[model samples]
Target: MTVQSIAGPRFSWRGPSNGWRQREGRGPTLALALFILVFSLIPVGRLIVAAFEGGFGAFWQVLDAPDVWRATRNTLVVAFGSGSLALLIGVVFALILSVTTLRARTALAFIMVMSLMIAPQISALAFKTLAGPASPLLKLVGLAPAPGTPNPMLGEFGIIVVMGLHHAPLVAITLASGLASIPRPLIEAARLDGASPWQVVNRIMLPLLRPFLLSAALLAFVAGTGNFGIPALLGLPVGYVTLPTLLFRKLASFGPATIGDAAAISVLIALIAGTGVIAASLLLARSASRLETDHRIEPFWELGRWRPAVEAGVWGVIALTVLLPLASLLATSLVPAYGVRLSPSSLTLAQYVEVLFRQDLTVRAFRNSMLLAGGAALSLAVITLVSAYVLDRAKPKVKAFAFALIELPYAVPGIVLAIACILLFIKPLPLIGVSIYATPWIILFAYHARFFAIALKPVMAAMATLDDAVQEAAVCDGARLGQRLRHIVLPLVFPAVFAGMLMVFLLAFNELTVSALLWSAGTETLGVALLSLEDSGLGAEAAAVAVTATLLVLVLMLAMQMLARRLPPNALPWQALAGPDRERRG
Candidate 1:
């Protein structure tokens, strides 16, 4: 029988029967495979080739650099440190929200997740502003660190702390999904056996969630390793460079002259990230448990007397991690200049006016970011809808390989993908003979390759829910493949399609890593513009840019939050936010 789940029906993504493939013929399957290979596999493969263009000598040359090795060491240490921290924070929030009567839990969960959508650089900037000697927020409270005192957030430790805070929500989202899988019967049996709420969690839930914990840890670790903005802002100024920042410095300093060297470094990064993924996969496989059930986890303990204290504690954490930093960022944006104390008399809107209206570069960045992100989102929505159908009907082996290719671009460091795009498209196309290098097209191409999977996942999951019976009936009634897809499947799955589109746009809009290497001239994304303003010593202007971008992300997130209520369970990343509400409704 098909699995019944917490959200309702748990749709298996297992491909349809071989007969469906036969009727559709090889055209769609081949087309999808080609699309995936061209966009994903080809770029990565081309990057690998570029890394070895000078044989083993060039690759070894990159590895031999003292700075390269130092950056690698730093990357590993920071990734593990931040990842462990994220695990701790995530598990606490997940358990508390799942099992305890935490008041304002919905708002807490929403804020926690919304924190994640704040761009990494913006986060770093905010915290930096908050802790700096001239911190407007701190100065206004007469607690700014004294001038000539070194900023506390300008080194390795700060990178780990900021990144950990930035990524904890990702861990929470992952763990929340696992928490929902826990069968209610097991918890009920424990309760009947006189087990306390804590006992049920420690004795049963955590063990079952081991696989998901490992998965979350891996996600946090990989994200840490690939993260550019955090290291760029927090680590780079003090010469505490990670691999990503090292790459950025290399190319930014020497431009095209260092492309070969950057490719070699990118190869090293991909290997490190890939090794981590493989290890995590092995760990997860070992820890796997069959957790499927109709009953989802729900609150087991009512903290009546302690509720206020617990709510206060949770809100305090939120304030420190999210609200304070953003407040500092806003204060910085309003100040007439960086390091100026924020006051009613000192505040000005000049930075916002300059960035939003007067600066040609910033204005173009806004337009470019929207076009690139909106284009990628729209294109992937259409492509994923078709690809999901083809994949759903393809042979198991074909489907698995295609899935791997689709994920590879996104899973590996964005720097790797950016390097791959440069390698693949640096020269003129064979037929067109027009180079896309140093142009917006390069950035757009990287977005498509990197975010294709993001757009595909929700759509694929939605495809899994399609009823074979309904399709068969449609076919029996003389409906063609195209007709059935157009009339029946598309309408049923449009919510997921829209959700995926929103996800892609959200990620692509404020993204920096890919465009860091790809962007040129008038083609700057918002991320590029913000970094430029900061580097040019226009900190107030940079803060304005960050605030603008963060507001847009929050607005989109709220819209998606409203949209998620109508989607099938787990169709969006923030689906975890809906679980407790779903439980309440049930």
Candidate 2:
């Protein structure tokens, strides 16, 4: 019964640094290392190198250019404007749902996040169709502006509003994490001291949540600077330009020679984003921001008299921002053309029919997108199994570096990755002499790079939760590494891995920015095709494409929701937002 007897004489203690690496994980370690280097490291390095090809001459030259300077200023302006709006909206919603007695929190959170889940281009399109003189929906309501009038949703105002609405959930979700950590006793103590709810929040909560506010603000700003779909659909038709759209336009207009200039601009954007991230981290690290306590989080703000009014206002905002735009998109899709008012006789399914079944480009786009998205998700899921395992045994510094590298592909703007991909693959492989540059393989590669961090995250988190003793016992019992992985590790983490794959697919499926820059003839994704149809004045067809893409995303998200019941808490983010009261969260 003693320890020496409980463990056999042959039993040896294992630590992260000892038996795992000494015995089994080398293969997976090597595999994940290679994967990271190829998919994440090379593209980023190539982009940085390309930007400084002439030893900072071209870099400084691009930064000094009038167009570059203008675009940078515009990006800063839009980012600031949109981030401010998003901060206001998101903070209001988060406080209401997380602290106040708000009804329909789940439904409201779902709708808010859905705005983000739907592609930014689709959101832009929906808002666009709900405005202007040519709007079929507005025309039916007799609210359409006079003919020849410009779309109100076509410049800085529209881009800022639309982008703010689309990104508000991001700000909300970030702050929700902060909000969930608040100790219940603090609020109780304040209430006992005769402090009003608003006073408590202003005096205590706001001070504690400064780190989250800073993080949320910087996150929104970075997202706005990197956003392509909103500006593309909203700002590009006008003279407005941001860095992402500017880089996209240059590459699209001037051809291959512009890649170098695009790289310089891309570097500039990456630097800005990087600076914000680093500053946020430094501030958070330096500040005494920890809020951990034994007390559970509980809502103390009871809106006894104002509940109904708040509900009405919330729903009214939802109607204006969510329901109306979506209804307009669907209505416009049903019509014969952009300006064709919706009526019994004017309704036609031709656009859906054409985009879904008939048009060659549309057909090819669907095929290519499905293949790219599916391929990337499947690839990342498999990659995560190995990468997560490797990282579980990796030292802290190595794991952190690996994670940061994986995130770089997604953190840097899609346009930067697109330019880097072009640079990296423009030449044939050194040995294989095979080029994937303009091929579907290139897009697939981009998806893997951009989404690998997302796929690895959930799996790594799940991996950390696993019982180390069980795996160690398996090792002690002479179960081979692969066998333990197949039987013990896989079943436990499968839910997380699947969740990661679903997230990757969801993000990759509706992606536009990366594919927009990287697409070629016959290789267009649904996003690219939607943009093409819209640019060609085929508004109905474009709406059809957007609606189709949104439906697919909805179906996949629904599947994830269904699967979420059996999975860990917060496996799907909407689940966390859906029911923050389900458990005593840390």
- For model 1 the TM-score comes to 0.94
Which parts of model 2 have CA positions greater than 4 angstroms off?
1-16, 282-289, 582-586
Residue 234 accuracy (lDDT) in model 1: 85
- Candidates in order: C-alpha RMSD to true structure: 4.0, 2.8
- Cα miss at 368, model 2 (Å)? 0.7
Least accurate 10 contiguous residues by lDDT in model 1: 4-13
lDDT of each: 0.85, 0.85
Query: Which candidate's TM-score is highest?
Result: 2
Cα lDDT over the full model 1: 0.85
- lDDT for each residue of candidate 2 in 1-586, tens digit (9 for 90 to 100): 1112135533332344555566684788789889989988899999989899988876898789999889999999999999999999999988877777777777788788888899999999999999999888888889899999999999999999999998898888877777776788888889999999999889999888898889889989988989999999999889899999998889889988888888889999999988777666555444434775556566678888988898899999989998899889999999988899998999999999998899999999998888899999998888999889888767777887888787888888788888889999999989999999889999999999999988888889888778767876876688887898899999999988888988898898889999998889989998899998988999999999988888887888777777775576665676565454532221
Model 2 pairs in collision: none
